[model samples]
Target: MTPQPFVAMKNIEKSFNGVPVLKSVTLEVEEGEIHALLGENGAGKSTLMNILGGVHQPDNGTILINGEEAKMADPRVSQEHGISFIHQELNMVSDLKVYENMFLGSELRNKFGFLAVEEMCRQTHEILAELGVNINPKEYVRNLATSYKQLIEISKALLHKSRLIIMDEPTTSLAEHEVNRLFELMKNLKKTGVSIIYISHKLKEIQAVCDRYTVLRDGQLVKTGMVENEDLETITKMMVGKAISQERFMHEHPFGETAMEVSGLTSTGHFKDIDFTVRKGEIVGFTGLAGDGRTELFESLFGFRKKYAGEVKINGQVVKIDHPRKALQAGIGYVPKDRKENAIIKDLSVIHNMSLSSMGNFERSGFIQDKKEREKFDVYKKALNIKVHNPRITIDKLSGGNQQKVIIAKWLEAETDILIFDNPTQGIDVGAKQEIYQQIIALSRLGKAIIILSSEAPEVLRICHTINVMYHGEITARFTGEGASEEEIMHYATGSKREGIAIG
Candidate 1:
């Protein structure tokens, strides 16, 4: 008799609101092998994983473990079957301690029914040490960094003695060193006969860590094969259905006078002595690794951090923006990072979300003009090629790329002369990214000043006219899009090199 694969999800199908997300998908994981689930955003990766995690039931499928059909009615049942899921947005409670979060729902108790705090802490320390994480088990999760929080999530999976672990974008927030550490830990886990289903958009990391690969496109399984047999381009083609171009998008534009200027911008602990100028009809970019202060600097510029000391000028006039309303009034609009948390209102309709920032334009006699809002939405919907069945549905029902388009439309309607987009295409896929880049270039051609803050060097290189690198709250390097290389940017982003003189 032949041995069975550790886990097999066969003929899975799922749909939402009459739209199929997963269609007869089959995934098999061998024990001790690191399997990759690759797909573009909205390619049904999340839907299939949610089914395996017991967050949703498949319309038709069989989940087998060790060749026996199994039923996973809920998350608890999945846990009982030795399946663990670590989500992209972590599920840890900030107020709780490390060990407390480790054993949150399934707590250890003594024979008298008393909580076994010491035993839990000891176990947490042992697991963390295996991953080279050195931290107090009693420390509050709120004080930990994002990477530490990510490790805690991974550790929780181990605590469950999970035979099969599902990691979704596990290294998104990790730095280079931390990511290396995680790779080592994953290797060790594999050596111990644990199977891992790794899901991520970072192709380089997927190539490095994944043993086998499965590509999904348009809710169907496109291919399943060994990672060693395929190249990045081939995998990307399977995911997006076409080859994605990596050409530079910066071209000669009729740039107008400087639209926004910042001099001596300093916020004690966040960012310091920042100076830069963004001209009308040009797109400037800020790129760096985690903790480079790019996000904080932009947040302060957008008036979210009022305690900052800086000289901000708009169209060559000094302006004071102590709040977002003032920033908007000054013709400076900010599209914040982490769109789900900072930009969109989940409960609102798609049209309402698009018109939120420019509500006054749709109001008559202190009442909203629904007809006018709908008309405007239709224009943007067509312009952006947004995929939505109905404008009345909730915005959360849309894909990541479509939701981002709606947010961009909202700011465009506000007629802000200068737009600051922080990680505009963070969770979006390659095909949708081309459309977004085109839209941004069109905006710049119309004489709107743009600032894009991104962590990805290639993204900044592809879109921006000028690129600025930040490190430890300082501007470390500047380059024209024509000359900036990823290696050059990384040297400054990691604080390996710096310029002596102030530049703007």
Candidate 2:
């Protein structure tokens, strides 16, 4: 008898707006196997996962469970098939308690037919305990840290009796220790025969947790085989169909006076006594595994955090920036991590959004707009290769990568001396990542002081003039050219006690 695979999909075909997303892509996941799905952004990796999770129905495909055909008409239907998905965007009610959030749809009913609060809390605690997750199930999700929220989302999959778990960029927002805990849990679950399909851009993660992999390129199958002996170079080659190089890194020009300075930068519990300096023309990359207060640090620096207590200095002049508007007026440009939330305006015209920050420069007599505004917009639009129907069209219509370029364009128009890029390449395609990387170095070459907060290790190594490692609101270690070691950095990042790590 032929032993059936635990899950299989044959000849999957899907498209969006007549563009082929998945073309004749077939995948199989044996029982208890961790299948690593690989692809550049928009290479049909997301589409395939979406179909499996009932988020989208394939135009043509056959899904089989234990060799028997199955129907996945909707997310609920997919859930019924014992498939639970943890998306990069955690969908949890912030106001609700963890226990209530866990028992959300299936609240335990007491004998009187009321909500069984005690029973639900007991079950949530049991689930958390079994997974070795140290969390109070009754605490409000908003009160818990972002890492704890991530664990809750993953645990929800287990509570649903899901045999096939699909995690998409699960650690994109987790701290170092939290990521290790998550990885350990993944191994434990796999030992118990639960299949995990992890999708991410972190190559090291795939190499560590995945035993087998399937590579996708331009909406087609490039390779599918066991991950054993499959190095990052090989996986990358299949995904991009080319060699990945570090040619974008350039020599640092002589830094001038301090372009920006922060003295005793603190935001209560988030970050404290954060002293840093960015010299003119220097690209200082502030890096840590996500949730190391990198984002919060920048937010405070840009005056987005009201409770922040810090002194900002530009060109050796101390200034108080009490709001984002004040920060922009002080010649500071900040490009946020979440493109949708912080950068682009969906309904606005591309030209309009690009010129928004510098609108006053484009206005005359406090009423009339000038052609110079459009010329400014076209300069960045063409330089960044922003794809759109027209400059007058909406900004949100572009792809993920294109949208990010628009965000940068908005800040570039402001002509700020100090640029704050918080995970600028997060969720963008590989090709787009390369493009943005080149732009970062370009900005530095133009004598713009750039500060980058990134989770991807390769990105920091490739562009930063110097690197600083942060842990629990403290600068743990600093690395200079040729001295930056990934292993040593990870050791301090993951809370190791050993010392002797160097600082640039």
Candidate 3:
């Protein structure tokens, strides 16, 4: 006879503002198993997880823990029931120390009701050691790297003695080695009978770590089965309801004269002697591991870093870009890496955010042309397939993928000849990524010089015409993207190998 599931969510249904987001979805998690929840953006994955974590209530559903009906009225009750959630944006106070964050709300006290610092540090050290993390328990969280911060989150979950943990995009900020370490720790946790609900867009990682998988599409469960029995393509098809092509997505386009050229672009300790050129109708990609300075280099190029020393030429004419305004005037547009923090204004309406940079063109006799602005936005909305009920609402209410599309629409309306996209598809879903890629290709075809900066080598290989690898602020290798290998790129990115180039 088969054993009962450790946790089961049956016939879950949720609606937002009278619009159904989840429809009769069911999920089951067995003890000591790593189960993956797979889906594209806006497919009801977050809503379902929120219901399990007690952040929201399902309109129609039943939750059972070990065949016993469970009521998750609040987060405290869920925690008491041995459930923990580690969100993508980690929930840790940066000002607090490591041990302080671990025992933030649930503190230890002595018989006299005094704070117990020694006991808390001891427990924190024990948990960190178990996870192969060696650091001072008193270290400030703000000073630590992203991977260490992620480790601290996992340690906190373990400290709660949680039987089940829900990890959302846990490896988004981790490096390759750090991801491997996390997978190892997950295996150890599984052996100890801790169930994990893994959610990520990286299908390769899902296949590597998860034992069982469930795919959700358009608020409905499409399929659930063992990961070992299905291929990545099959799983992707189930999620998006179509087969996605893996070949290069760039279409035939004629390359034009150079649009932007940089020489001796040095930011002193960040990057050194960076030399590259992007031509109109060309797509160039810069890729490296963490701390390789790819993002820093692009930030400087876009005039966000004023201390950088570089000779920049736009359309074969030398220009000085000391501020973002200057970069815009020079016909260079940049889509920053972090959309929520860097690109989107939380309080601004979606239409206003799209027309923010181009407001001058939308002004008529000292009056803003709201209708004209929205008419332009409607064109992009249709072309990009952006889903939004009301354009007057705040941009933050949309999904990450849609928010990114709005940002892209903003830059496209600016009509810049040189465009730089840093981590173009950083937090986006699989289907949205392909759409963005197609948009980039379309921009290139329209005689725009496109530059893509990403850490994922596969992303660059699939869409870029030229790929440059950087290590320690230096360009280590350059591939034509005709037949570039991730292994070769990683070797240079990790500083294991370098190609000597003469500095001018």
Candidate 4:
């Protein structure tokens, strides 16, 4: 006989500005089950999960917890019901001590209503120890590594004694070994009767940890099935709702000229002893597992991360990059991974975001931001095919694909000779992805030096003139056009040793 589910959501529909983002989605999770919610970028998976967490109210739906109907009016209401969401973007206050962060707003108070600091720290310490994470609960969260902070966040959820835990892209900032540890922790938690809803773009991890997967695409339920019953290909097809040409994004170009050079570049906790060069008219894809430090390397180059050890030069001339402003001065443009967090101000208009980074160009006497200066932004705005009635509408209303296009537009409007795109196609649909690649190729043809860091192997193989495999804070293998092979890169990236490789 089938047991009644612990939590169930039925016929959930959500919309923003009259656009349907989630349509009649149904999902059920039993106690002790690790259910994965699978979908491509902007596929309403996040929306559905957000609705469950009381982050957003669904337009139409019924939510049931243990056969009892409930409407969560706030995140606290959801938490009171033993449901907690660990967002992909870590939200713990960095300046606060770890213990303070863990028990934030839920602090235990003494008889006089004063904060019981030591009591909270002791409990936090015990929890961290139980999770097999080595750290003092009193340590500052900002000083800790990303992987450790994530573990702390997980510990925070467990502190609530949550019955249903939803983790959104929790693996993005973890090291390879750390990911393994997390999977083990998740499995152990599942055995203890805690239901987990895990969401991620990393396909391989889903195959290992999830028992069942509920796929969402274009705001509707595509299907729900057991993970053990499906292979990666089937899962991919379901996520996209059709056969997507996975290989269409790959087409290497014949790159030319040394466009940018880095020598002995280093930054604390970000990158160390980095040295590489990008050629004009070529796409050089940088691939490594999450937390392998690929993004850090670019951040260092872009002047966001201060360079403490080495030098960067463009076209064989030494450039001074003391800051991000200096990096742009050196003709380098960067598109960050999280479009909302790093790339876009969602409250601004589409053209506003597109023109933001390049706004300095239109300034007159350092005062007025000329309206005519926006003409430069319009060129790329139309070129990228942004879906908007006008550039004056706030950016948050556009689709994920259009938001990404505006980010690209922000960089293109800058007169940068070299560009670094970090996971530029992360959360968009197939057609938008195709259009983005087209834009990239167009940039390469215009002799822009492009360096892309992507998890998708085929995306790397298709666009890059040269591919660099990074592992454990070093470049493991450098593959050129003819020699580029996915198997070789993966093996090296996964820590397989090859001769003639030593911290290169």
Candidate 5:
């Protein structure tokens, strides 16, 4: 007799607006195992998960749980079936308190049916403590960092006590230590016979924690097997259909005169004494662990934060920019980190979002030129390989990676002389990352100054011509990108070493 898998979806077929998204894809998962769902952006991984999560229904499929056919009619039904989904874009209400967000739909009540605020707070604290996170349960969620918000979302899932949890890009905003703690908790949950369907583009993390793997590409199943049986290159090839090289990018064109230079740029309590120069035709990267203040420094430079003590020289002329409009007027364009919160206007159409920042480019005599706007968008869509069936659809309907591409296109259309991308590929896949890198490189070659801020050292190493490591709100070291190794970068990033030397 054959043992039945815990969950099985056989011959799943789905389409949206007559476009096939999942073509007879099949998947099976066993009890107490971490199953990885791997694929590039717009590869139907999310659509398949949405079907299982009850956000969408498959046109044709049979889902069996514990050898019994089950129908997930809605999100609540999926939760009732012991399934919990933590979506990639966070669902936290910024105005709510930590405990309130944690107990949103499933609030505790006393005998009289009054809200048991104290009891809810206590449970919230306990669950957060389990993840090595400590915060006042009454604190507003908007006051917390993105990393803490992500932890709160995870704790909310644990509160449900679900038999199966689907985590999508769960660690995208977490620090190294936080990621480690979460992995430990995941292993503990597995010991208690809880199953997890993990979806992430970080292949290394998948190899570390996942038991089995499934690959999907272009709305179809391509491979499925044990994680231990395949190397990263082979797995990457399955997801992207090509090899992705991790070598440093070589620049043939020489850097022009300094486009932007900063000295003693200090934002009180955020960053201090940040000094660097970005030349036309050069790509400079700033990298560090969480709380290292690289993001804050760049935010100040981009005029998102006004009260900063600094001297900023653009083309050797000192400029004061205390607002985003001023930053744009100064020929600076910024692609912020959090896409859902900071980058896109969810209700706007994809083409509108692309042209929102540079409305002048699509306007003629105080009127929007629809045909001109679409023609310009079509160029970027093809260049960036954006996977959108119709430009008229709302921006929120696109995948995270594709949303990021749209944001990038928005800046490119703005035609800024200097561009700043903070965590540019935060939720992007390996293949899409390569395309973005090539685009950045091409931009630099055309005499645009580029600044990249990323927590991943390897990312800066792979693309930048100059690298700066930050620790405790200061620049600890600077290295020519080609000569610096990841180990050396980590040494400064971790506050273990400091040096002020220029080398090529």
Candidate 6:
């Protein structure tokens, strides 16, 4: 006599290589509701979602769709059942055009069976407009920014008439305005009887958009309740098993002489008139909205962009770096964003990836010393709280947070005096994020000069010693991290204010 829920996964059990990832987990989603899946990085959230998306099969479970048992044998079968999964790591093909990537597997066709290019582009334009993104649908995906690519992924999900959409960290690369637009669109979708399984590490965004919450810890469901009834600290405690403080990190140690100084750094279309100095034991952060050129500016400094006008001094001595090798040789290390494409070699073992940048440390007699590498990796593994059953496994087998830890270990092993981290905690959970912040602070305490690039203003405010706000390829404001507020940062980030202070 009672109506059935739209979707249900009852008593799901899964394991990988004898390690239980999900233990008798159960979930239910009503029609047209936004249900948030919350957990720490390795807490089995992805494993559960993968099962629903048909990327993996559960060892034991009953998945019911509208009260009928549904066997999700493959991703295609899941798609047939009106499920759309927007993955955290983007799945876009760089070589394809925007519209082409949008309709890659499900292409529209004319009566003659030829590709309906015009229709596809028009539809792409229509969907992107809903997200306030304007791009040439015929343009190659490689040319677009990460934020635009993220929007395209969301648009792809909307293209399919999915009854339930599973979004994993959908707003990771989006700007403030763009994220607002997405929330609006999600609300509209919910109004049309569509359900969403929202997975995000950002607790505030979950509070903003999700209607209900489910917390998973150590591969088991710990709590499930309405979002309005619980506070963020309570939800965070459920996810991480402790309370996390939002206070700014205190640095009482005095900075040493400038480790890196930039004067009049300019790249024609990327950034202009950039001037800053990072001293030993200093943490400097640059933040802004999407397309603000913060990433490009740092990419140039790291030698990824060769053509730039600047005077760069490392340890008070001028240097020229035109390649990544030269940057490394200059004692400048970079941990780039987009870990899948730039940070990790998926096929390589976890220990090898950790030692990739500093192979010399593990080499003797022209041969790599596996024992030495593993020994060094063990130190970082424990310090970073990396969860890995075996170091011999490929780096791709680790969770995203663990992969990021490996990348950080690679740079630390290199012993670079100057370090740059772009979106360091992009996809990591709150607890893992706190650990990374402490690591960065520890590195600074050890006299390493650190530069961080983040789109989130609050992140910079939390850890950096100095905060620089960028807008339209220019540094619009500079404030001491302790004195800066999110409101003031947004004012400069949006190009509504312009003020600069001398950086020493």
Each candidate's clash count: 0, 0, 0, 3, 0, 0
Q: What is the C-alpha lDDT of each candidate?
A: 0.87, 0.78, 0.86, 0.79, 0.91, 0.90
Give candidate 5 misplaced runs (Cα > 4 Å). 501-504
RMSD of candidates 1 onward, in order: 2.7, 3.9, 2.9, 4.0, 1.3, 1.8
Q: Name the runs in model 3 displaced over 4 angstroms.
A: 94-99, 118-151, 501-504
Instruction: Single out the weakest 10-residue window by summed lDDT for candidate 2.
Output: 495-504
lDDT of 2 by residue, 23-88 (tens): 999999887888898887557776788888888899998999889898788998888888999976
Worst 10 residues of 5 by lDDT: 495-504
The true-versus-predicted C-alpha distance at residue 53 of model 6, in Å, is 1.1
Q: What tens digits encode model 5's per-residue C-alpha lDDT throughout 367-443? A: 99999999999998887778899999999999887888899889877889999998888888898888889889999
- Against the true structure, candidate 3 reaches a TM-score of 0.91
Q: lDDT per residue, candidate 3, 1-504, as tens digits?
A: 899899999999998778888999999999999999998777778778889999899999999999999989988888988999887666779999999999999999999999899999999999888767898999999899767888888889889888999998787667777788789989989999999999998999998999999999989999889999999999999998988887777476679999999998999889999999989999999999878888888878778888888799999999988898899889989998756556889789999899998888799998999899888889888877676778999987776567778987887777788999888877677777888898889889899999999989999989998889999999988887775788888888888888563121
lDDT for 132 in candidate 6 is: 94
lDDT of 1 by residue, 1-504 (tens): 767999999999998988888999999999999999988766788778888888899999899998899888898888888899987666889999999999999999989999999999999999999877899999999899767988899889988878899998787656677788888988988999999999887888889999999999878999999999998888889988899887888567878999999999999888999999999999999998888889889888888889888799999899988898889889999998666556889899999999998899999999999999999999888776676878899998786557878997887787889999988876666676777888888899999999999988999999999999999999998888877889888888888888653233
Cα RMSD, model 6: 1.8
Q: Report the C-alpha displacement of residue 143, candidate 4, in angstroms.
A: 4.5
Give candidate 1's root-mean-square deviation (CA, Å): 2.7
- Report the lDDT tens digits of candidate 6 across residue range 1-504: 867878899999999999998999999999999999999888888888889999999999999999999999999999988999998778999999999999998999999999999999999999999999999999999999888999999999999999999998898778889999999999999999999999999899999999999999989999899999999999999999999997898875899999999999999988999999999999999999887989889888988989999899988889998898888888999999877677889899999899987888889999999888888899888877788999999988887767877887787777899999999988888888888899889999999999999988889999999999999899988888878999989888888877565232
- Model 4 worst lDDT run, 10 consecutive residues: 495-504
